[model samples]
Target: MTAVQQPLAPHEREMIRDELLRSLTKLERSLKSSGAAARPRDLEQDTVGRLSRVEALQNAGFTKNLEAREKAQLEQILSALRRLEDGSYGACNGCGAPIPFERLQIFPETLACGTCARG
Candidate 1:
C-alpha cells in the first residue's frame, strides 16, 4: 500500500536541492579529471607488451561505461533541480501525486512515487 504524502517543508526542499547540487558539482569535477585517463593510449609508440595494451583497452572501456553512468546521473540531478524550480519537486511525474518525504529524503532526484514505480 502507498502512503499519502504531505507537502514538503521549504527547509526540506532546500536541503535536498543543496545535496543534489553538491553531488552534481563533485561528479562533474571527477568526470573531468577522469576523462584523460579514459582515452586510448598511444599503443603504437609505447613499448608495452600486447597483454598490457589489451589491459589498458579494457580499463578504458570500463571507464567509458562509468562516465556514461555518471552523465546520466548528472542529467537526472539537473532535471530534479528544474522540477524544483517549477513547483513540481517532491511530486511523482507518473501520477501527479506528492511523493513521500522519506523517499525524497533518500532519493532527491526521484520522479515517480513508490506505487507508480512498482507498476
Candidate 2:
C-alpha cells in the first residue's frame, strides 16, 4: 500500500513562498534592465560597419534568449505562488505525490517531483 504523504508545514510553505516572491522580484528587475539590449538595432551601412553590425545582431539575439528564459521562470514562480494561495504548493502535479522538502528548497517553483520530472 502507498503511504500517505504529510503536507508541508506552515513555516515550510511560508519560507518557500518568500523565496518565490524574492525570485519574482529579481527576474522582473533583470527583464526591465535587459529590455534595451534586446531591442532591434539599426544596421544602416553609413552608421555601422558590417562586422560591428553583425556583432550587435548576435548580442541582441543572446539578450533576447536570456529574456525568454527569465520570462519563463517568472511565469513558473507566479504559478507556484498561485498554487500556494490555493493550498496546493508542495504536491507534485504529475502523480499527486507530496514533493520532498529538499527538492522544494532547491526548486521553489517546480510543479513535479524528480521522478515525474525525469519522465
Candidate 3:
C-alpha cells in the first residue's frame, strides 16, 4: 500500500518559509561575527606560549569547520526557498511525490520523501 501525501497548506508553507528566513538570517549573522575565514593565526606573537598557540590553532580549525557546515545548511535553506517560489517545495525530488507537511515541518530543507530519503 502506498501512503498518500498531502500538499502543504499555504499557511503551513508560509510558516516554514518564515522559519527558514529567520534561520538564514541568524546563521549569516553568526558567520559574520565569527570571522573564521578571514581570521589569521599569529603564531609568532611573543606573549603566546607554545601550548596556548597549539590550542588556539585547534580552536580556529574547529571554528572554521563549524562555519563551513553552517554555510552549507544556509545554502540548503536557500534552495528550499527557491523551490517554494517555483511551486515545488513540498514535492520530493527523487520520486516526484508530495512530501508530508509534518515531515517538512521537522526538516524544512528536505528535498525527498521519507521512503526516497531512506533509500
TM-score of every prediction relative to native: 0.88, 0.90, 0.87
Can you rank all candidates by lDDT, best first? 2, 3, 1
When summed lDDT is taken over every stretch of 10 residues in candidate 2, the lowest stretch is: 1-10
lDDT at position 22, candidate 1: 91
TM-score, cand. 2 vs. native: 0.90
In model 3, the worst 10-residue window by lDDT is 1-10
Candidate 3: which stretches are off by over 4 Å? Answer: 1-6, 36-38
**lDDT by residue (tens digit), candidate 1, 1-119:** 23325557889888998989998999899799779789767887369888988888899999999999989999999998887787768878788789888888788899888999898
lDDT of 3 by residue, 1-119 (tens): 13325557779989999988998999999999778554986778798998999888888888888888988998999998888887778888789889888888889999898999999
lDDT tens digits by residue: candidate 2, 2-93: 32267788898889988998999999999999997787767899989989998998899899999999999999999988888877777888
Prediction 1 global C-alpha lDDT:
0.84
Q: What ranking of all candidate models by TM-score puts the best one first? A: 2, 1, 3
